[model samples]
Target chain A: MNSRVVISNIVRWVLLFFVQVFLLRNIGFYNLSAPFIYVLFVLALPFGIPNLLLYILAFGTGIVMDAFYDTLGVHATACAVLAFVRISFISVTVNRDGFDEPEPSLSGMGFKWFVLYSLLCIFFHHLVVFFLEAFRLNEIGYTLVRCLLSCIFTLFLVLLAQFIFYKRKSR
Target chain B: MRNLWIFLNRYNAFFFLIIFFVAGIILTVRNNAYQRSVTLNSTNGLVGAAYEHLNVVKRYLNLGMVNDSLAKENALLKTEILALRSIDSAKDVTVKDTLRNVQYTYLPAKVIKNSFTLRNNIITINKGRLDGIEPDMAVISPQQGVIGLVRDVSDHLATIRSLLHKDTRISVAIKKNNALGSLIWGDRNFDIRKAFVTDIPNHVKMSVGDTIVTSGAGEFPIGVPVGRVRKTNVSTGDNFLAAEITLFNDFSNLQYVYVIKNKYAAEQKALELNSKNDE
Candidate 1:
């Protein structure tokens, strides 16, 4: 990645990290739905980014969140899953030769593609997060509900953020 | 060997995923001893400072309610002091209890960050090792009820494993007849205002509205309020009774808490260890 892209990604990580911890941490509805907007940073990484690097970035992001949540491994594990799924999903759907922009942002990828991408990634991430946090088989139903609700919440926040701040790249 | 090395390189990302996944599981499984990583929790200086600043605005919004509670507590303490003073002045009758000694001291601390939504909730308080706080010290609400135990300590901050956490099980007793049991959080629905009192002897009769308090078998002093029974039923597969309790403290909007320091804890622990050794 170029210097500009690298700097912008770092800035995005910092901003999303702060927003997730300071603003969204306590906003869960009845202890069920929590929006993990920080994962958007991982979801928005460029398709051309190296696979190993993406895994490291995702893990790093998750571990930082785990630190603040006092749940050291739960978030990290989930983020690692998100990175793996992202690599697999992108390879299946996106034709690299067709994209003009480096990153798979909202404006570059149409609404349908972007939504599907975020939905799948965030769903897997939230699934791992809730189930791992619960750490039980008996409470599978409760954990599933929490995971589904959180996935919807996180997906909505991610789309809102993309539409609000994402700019169309100039040729 | 060349083919094997090429295959490994081809799927290096998958291998890394497994490595990180296992590392994450190890961390989660070792959560019981997570306090060893004091630098990685909210009690860390950077995270604590941010939460402290955020709490400043949040605390301002709740000032009215906080003041009302403080006023109510002040009135109660004044009445208690007056009663004690009156008792002291009656020279004809001498009242002394050999069993009553100052055993617990309360160190007041502000809650910088608290979470009740998570299955395993933790509360970060402004006090830390510098303020003479340490792990396993009981934390209580300022309004007089159990909160949780101090789980980790840093230089200027600490994290409390709140009562709402699934792993928190406190020894408690029924107030009217002293039926002892253990206080535990929810099984399915992670309710913040309620917990379950389990393992009470089946022979003990329990009813709605009976008060529950700490059994003094743990870190908390005797008679610290825990909750009141909302419902009671016989547990299956065992001869123990369980009761649903409505907690006195609202774990959601906690502003300030007191970390209790047991003066005789070290002595008591040493004695217990000696006895165990003899056995």
Candidate 2:
């Protein structure tokens, strides 16, 4: 919204991109689970942003990821799904918590709300990612297991990142 | 018209979602067909440069293992050279050698990024069109033997569709019996160390620990080591026998590879195309 907020968001975007491609790309758990911490940039966007702008930002983030991962449109499709889910979830739940909060970050939206939000978003993202990447129905079980494991891994890393950087909301 | 415009404006977000989603799907399908342009892949200059710089740090950490493997390969080559020289000295050449024309030449390359955990793993190497590497060129490891085939190339980097990929298929044969089959990965399991050898005739005698080597019908040269049969008589719906094999290449720690250039590939391809055109 403001200069400071815009600058910080840009910085977070770059930092998360590097972390995803350079750091988390190499750290897979037994070839099954991979943490996509870059999704945090989409999830933690400020509340007042327009829905159309949000989708574009999410698409941009995902397309870049697709480039590095060599999965062309897989991540982009998932990110679009994530963006749609985030918009719907926020509209449904944010009114209860008051619109004063700037972002749906852990520190801003409280622990319980943020956890549910991230879990839902990351699950859908990984679901689309693994299913599309595999692109076969015969391996549904293996794909589902991989999706769930990666969802948990990505959620954990996102939480750790939030805790380390975002300050607690003042009452 | 006013109502239609209002409705369209109201659901514009949904339309945007559909547009982006379809775009992504098209890209995915085009890529799966293996016809994707090189612009968005890791072989692009920017992404390749980043991975190349990162590999500098990674290569340093694995310097000891790389040096040891190189030394071992050098020793093996020395012994073979000595044996060949001794045989040559024992007899003078009386006839012109017709098969001595070079067919395959290898160019050394450093692997910038490699993935084996995913179902469709792709390896990025630091050589590209500038180094004479092209799509379908065979890549082999000094220590582990057959690695993969080059999928795409940029100016300074290339991506390899490794044997772990679901779509990868290489022609291989049982070394002892010359029974031919196709080598594939991720048939039943996502394990990097394991692969499947299918299409072997059911009548062909096979046993555990039987050696498998490239058949030279595809990208690789003849007799390059592929794997060893780990399990026999794996159940398949068809009459063909499928055996589980343990790959010799430790893809998890692959650092360097050789991109093999087939000098006569263009000529052979042209001749083959001529017959297809005739049909």
Candidate 3:
């Protein structure tokens, strides 16, 4: 809620957006998988931000991302869903009694919590995004394989970002 | 009223979820014809401009490799120019096909984005509607082979469906026997650069090294180099021959290409379609 935290979060949002659009868009693994690392923005938000505020931020980020990727509302929808469901995972996994971390980054949430959180978050994100992109019931087999591969790819990038950039240890 | 306000505030995120899903469904389900908010289609200048600036920097990194390919293409064109000049100089005495009416014109473009590994690969070129490029225009690499077809056009950018795409089935023919067939990309590994010329009768005396070229009657002009037969096998039905051809154009190394606008394509297509309708 402080000005400095808000400013830094804004900076992180912009940085993640540009990196996803610029660097990651071109980095394809056999054209089958492109990492959706921008979701790290949603994953890294202050854990206590108002649910409505977080959802709006995630949805806005998704829309802008969809604009760049030319997928329309696809990213927004997935991001919105991710934001809404994010709290459910946190309550169950995080050691809430002892830890009072504001952000849910790998540094803040302990390694295990962050890993599971990112895998689940990216899994659903890619699942919705790719399946929506294909939008065919008959091609469910192809769509599922694409979703699984992309989920793994996006999860790897999101996890990598935490280790590389989240230099300070919260614990 | 107090209870209603509290519930609304408590479930605000859930409220937006429904809104976002509805908006998403509308955007995804509508085809371009029904789409009014079509800027989300990478054809928008906002997205195009960003990619353009990025490609400018990336294109610089590949300068050496691109220069080599440009030189090779230039040498090939120079020899062709010399051949054309000779024919022009001898035109008064010799009747030639070069004297035939010009049917197509070439527009130069650079490939800003090309994905070689995608099963249905799409390519982005730095020319678009503003540059007189349109969907269905034939795209070919500088060295003379099919690249793809212009699929969509923004103001200054266009996307091409690469020949490497699984859906591509271009009309091609064997050079020696002139047996017509269609060319396709990999059946097993979609990333494979080779193409297969399918539907030529089994009796056609084809062998390894037999050249395949665009039949010239369809999307491509006649006789542009396609590929040479690298391997042949009986197509699954056992009646037709299918040859694996090593493509002349390297999709991975592609940089510049020529987009061909056939002046008579519209008229010819109308005539052909009209005849088909009669049948």
Best DockQ among the predictions, by candidate number? 1
Q: What local lDDT score does residue A71 receive in model 1, on the 0 to 100 scale?
A: 90
Measured against the true two-chain complex, the DockQ scores of the candidates, in the order shown, are 0.28, 0.26, 0.24
TM values, all candidates? 0.45, 0.46, 0.44
Residue B24 accuracy (lDDT) in model 2? 86
Clashing residue pairs in candidate 2 (N, C-alpha, C atoms within 3 angstroms): none
lDDT per residue for candidate 1 within B1-279, as digits (tens), equals 999999988877788789989988877767724433542563587888998999999999999788657755654563354344434343434446522344566677788998989888899998899889978999888786799999999999999999888888899999999889999986775778888999999889989999999998988877889888999893546878899999988988898887888877888889999999999
> Each model's number of backbone clashes?
0, 0, 2
Q: Give the better candidate number (1 or 2) by DockQ.
A: 1
Q: In candidate 3, what are the lDDT values of residues B1-279, reduced to their tens digit? A: 999999987667668778877776666556323234543553586778998899999989999787767755764574455345434343354555555445566677878998888678899998889988878888888886799788999999999998978787789989998999898885775655688888888778888999899897876777778888998884657678788888888898888878877767888899999999999
Docking class of 1: acceptable
Off by over 4 Å in 3: A94-99, B1-12, B30-279
Worst 10 residues of 3 chain B by lDDT: B31-40
Q: How well is candidate 1 docked (DockQ)?
A: 0.28
- Could you give the fnat of all candidates in order? 0.68, 0.59, 0.55
lDDT of 3 at B146: 90
Arrange candidates by lDDT, descending: 2, 1, 3
**Candidate 2: true interface contacts recovered:** 0.59
